[model samples]
Target: MKVRDKVIVVTGAGGGIGRELVFNLLYKGAKVAAIDINSDALEETLKQAGGDGDKVSTHIVNLTDREAVEKLPEQVISCHGTVDGIVNNAGIIHSFVNINDLDYDKIKLVMDINFYGTLYMVKSFIPYLLDRPVGHVTNVSSMGGFLPVPGQSIYGASKAAVKLMTEGLYAELKDTSVNVTVVFPGGVRTDIMKNSKVEGVPSTNDTDKAHDHLLTPKEAAEIIINGMEKDQYRVLAGKDAKMMDKLYRLSPQRAVSIITKQMKKIINK
Candidate 1:
């Protein structure tokens, strides 16, 4: 489970937390296959990885494609000789829109990229992971996955699906050496809105402006990798997520009211 000297494949390795994961994993002495849809971005990440080029490799693939995902385990094996774990960090946000104003196409798009894409990678890599004496899987689900966000309903739905799917995987793989972890990341300092290509809205959420407590990508990555090293079933990055988890558990209606009020203020503004 420790990434040190282990071969780990990471998706969405172009920027944000994914890129940070690559840098951190390599620093921890893991043989890394950095994957992303943007070959140029991957190149950028590779360049930023500094030395240890021998321990790092890059791959370009769209995770939504099952056939493309199916080839990943083999490609990583060819590059690194063996696989030890995977971090499914690739995801996209939905256009900020209310449920009634939402476009079905947009919902489908987010679902394909954020939820099904993660599932494709898990499905493709499970056999190989099972074959290994020990392996790990980490899925990045947003805090919105559990706490319903007003404008990002579809995005929340997608991530919520990932949360449940990952939890189910952990139960199924309980006896196996493969550990499953689902990460709940609150607001982190990243260009996720730009990456998701949001239009006609401020990139940051209303609450983000009120509280500048976003975690840095590197910090988030460190927390995530630490959880992976320990084979944790759940990893909450950022204080907001940790706090929200407790609040939601304590009072679902009150939690929804608090978040919905913040988002509604932005919508009405």
Candidate 2:
């Protein structure tokens, strides 16, 4: 699972942690196939990599399109020669609104992008990955995916699906060279809200109380890639995600109550 010399395919590689992963993977001497919906952003990621960009391949495609997702492995192999791993890091959140007040289309959008998009990448890439001597798949689910956030119930449900799906994949692929890692990140400092087209500031629990206690994209990517190399079954990024995982495991009702109090401020604002 070490990324060194591995041909790894990364979705959402245009920005945020995905962009950071491209950089770190290059630093590790991995042949990276960077996939994103935005061509310009993907170029920017390559630009940031400086000379290391030579080791990377950039693909602009929408994960929501099954055909596009399915074709990625072949395109990557054609460009990078082989596939060894994949990072399902693309995801989005619905606008901060209660389920009752939100449109069902918004819910579907979240589900399609966050849950099914990850699924498409996994299904399309797994056959190729299985052909390798060893491969790893890292699926990013949110803390919201597990714990209840008042205005983000639908978003939570979608990520919850990803959480369960990835675990199921782990069980099925346990005997294979392919490894599965499910990541739960707390609050990451990224442009995901803006990328998701969600306007306005979120109710943040940052130390400053103005931003989410956000882990930088590079920090989060390092933890994730390191976890993949170590073949960890689960990786929790950020202190908040670790704390919430423990709290929710011990008392789901209490956890939900705590989240509601914090989220109410954001939703009402």
Candidate 3:
């Protein structure tokens, strides 16, 4: 999809990759509707975007709430006149814990925000997209979506659900004007940890080891934009993401073992 002049709506626009995506899309001449639960962070994103208020609009919405998500299309349409694309970038991660010991409430929270949130957005926007000749939906899954991470099982499951759901949407919409793209992003410098629900997990920690192999949000956004333009079904955001996808494809068991070993060190710390 040519991002120039496209009317785009990005959820979780207050944080990390979402914030970067909004800025990048704005620079590419897309009118953006930025949505996040955090008003302050949304304001910060707007300030950083440096676009005319008319070019960028912000909405404080709790994505997990189906009612709120249901209203998003109308709200976005009111602001942009039409919706050409949507980035389901809003997500939440639960704390690292064995399934047996995991807090059910927290797990529900994660699933609601990460899984149902994506579904709600897609459900609400598909009608509008169908009206147009072409539309795009870019969902941000994670490297964990392909490989199991012991402590972050809930997060992994949520993203895995997203992966499959997105693929299903792609297969079903292949002949249509709407396109679906799923992204698997490896480590990146972001505030996700601070906002995540990982119990006993530090709000802030050095990700230097991961950063060495991390793709900046700008890089990831570029890859995603290109993938959407080319109508790619999957977009791997970094070397690590691509390698992991390859490994999982060649040997699922071995890939899981390797991811388990690497994640053990982080979770056990």
How many pairs of residues collide in each model?
Answer: 0, 1, 3
Task: Compare the candidates by lDDT and give the number of the best one.
Answer: 1
Task: List residue ranges in candidate 1 displaced over 4 A.
Answer: 204-211, 265-269
lDDT of 2 by residue, 1-269 (tens): 88888998888999999999988988888989899999999999988888354588899999899999999899998987889999999988878877888897888888999999999999998998898899999999989888988878898999999999999999999999999999999988888888888876552323555464679899999999999999999999999899999999999999999988877776556
The candidate 1 region of ten consecutive residues with least summed lDDT is: 202-211
| Per-residue lDDT of candidate 3, residues 1-269 (tens digit) | 88889999999999788998898888788999999999999999999988578999999999889999999999998988999999998887776778888888988999999999999999999989989888999998999998888888889999999999999999998899999999988876666877874456543346555446667777777787788778788998888888988999999999889988977766666
lDDT of 1 by residue, 4-95 (tens): 88999899999999999999998898999999999999999988897455899998999888899899999999988999899999998877
User: Which ranges of candidate 2 are over 4 A from the true structure?
Assistant: 51-53, 202-209
Better of 1 and 3 by lDDT: 1
lDDT of 2 at 262: 75
Give each model's whole-structure lDDT.
0.90, 0.89, 0.87
- Badly placed stretches (over 4 Å) of model 3 are 202-210
Please identify which of the two predictions, 1 or 2, would achieve the higher lDDT against the true structure.
Answer: 1
TM-score of model number 1: 0.95
